[model samples]
Target: MNADFPFRIVGFDLDGTLLDTSGDLAAAVNHALTSVGRPALSVEEVRPMIGGGARHMLAQGMAATGGCTEGELDVLQRRLLDYYAANIADKTQPFPGCLAALDNLTGRGVRLAVVTNKLEHLAREVLDALHLTSRFDAIIGGDTMGPGRGKPAPDPVLAMVQRCGGGSAAFVGDSVYDVQSAQAAGLPVVACSFGFLQQPVETLGAEAVIDHYDELIPTLVRLGSAA
Candidate 1:
């Protein structure tokens, strides 16, 4: 309802931003660890290890389990992915007020997109399982562009803008990667306070932070107007 809102495209990170996927992601991490004779990790224990991607999350779990060989990690990574794709939505759901917030944005003619470090098929699979795939105007994953150019780099963020038909954009996410990427892309970012903050949320260096999705639109209005 704030007509002065300046952004046209609003991009979001998938895992910790829009959806609370910590439960299922932790299960996949624990499954991979236990198969290699390592102990299982609790969901709360694995919360901070997420966000980068499956391999990064598994690496953290493996490191906690005393580490494993590169070849062993390769096999375990595949195993983790399989299990995660199989049970993608078992414990995953949109964060409280997320759908309503998205509805508000859509009604305001803002284009919505998802740009995640999650692999393409897997991100789409999880979105499909939740029947939420139709919500976004675009979905770009880690592998969608190329290797090593996912986040903390401007490639995918630029791609999000291009794919959304080129307009002033802002990104919403829950991690340093998200902040780093958006800043690199020359866009303002809003961090989610309730997300899987690996460190203190203040450390992310975002323009604004919201404790809940209900605050998102007003936060965006301020961020956009200030820009």
Candidate 2:
């Protein structure tokens, strides 16, 4: 392994790992819930529902508000998406030091990509709205690879490596999906403790855990050393 940086490519989970999008997401979910006469959820309550994507988030929200039929869920899901798209970045911003950490990795010749469970266009819209589109080599979304092939399946991570020119890679994310996918892809992972985690960070099973972006590169360096 090269001592400078063992990985040539680094993949990230978008919603929690890169951006603090819980506020906007909670608003969208509340929009849908209100449309169906259900009560709203707090940002803290909605944060854990986010990792699996909009539909999953809505499902969780509806479950909290007396559940819904497939038909009801479908209508609410579309409403949630439309509301979210229109205000994708109202309160969304990069987690502290994420941009600098990206820059640090880029300076080291490490390519970066986002492997999100968000739908492709929504992810693009959110990134574009935040003016962060140019920072990544690729932004693979939940639907990008068809049904059931998002994170935790290893497919998206494998695709990210290929799209970034097929070298050693690592994944940075906050959820079990992220860690599982990286491990499945034979890569090390770093979990972000500050992210909107559904479970406790200790259960993520990543090679390392970081509380801030300032710790990201150093954690990666240590992972590289161990590799």
- lDDT for each candidate structure: 0.93, 0.92
**What would the TM-scores of all predictions be?**
0.98, 0.98
lDDT of 2 by residue, 96-174 (tens): 9999999888888888999999999999999999899999999999999999999889999999999989988999999
Residue 100 in model 1: shift from native, Å? 0.2
Q: Tell me each candidate's RMSD, in Å, in order.
A: 1.2, 1.2
Q: Poorest 10 consecutive residues of model 2 by lDDT?
A: 1-10
**Model 2 regions more than 4 Å off:** 1-3
Query: How far is 223's C-alpha from truth in model 2 (Å)?
Result: 0.2
Q: Write the per-residue lDDT of candidate 1 for residues 1-227, one digit (tens) a residue.
A: 33666889999999999999999999999999999899999988899999898899999999988988889889999999999988998999999999999999999989999999999898899899988899998999999999999997899999999999998999999999999999999999999999988988888999999999999999999987787
Cα lDDT of candidate 2 equals 0.92
**74 in model 1: Cα distance from truth in Å?**
0.2
Model 1, residue 107: displacement in angstroms? 0.2
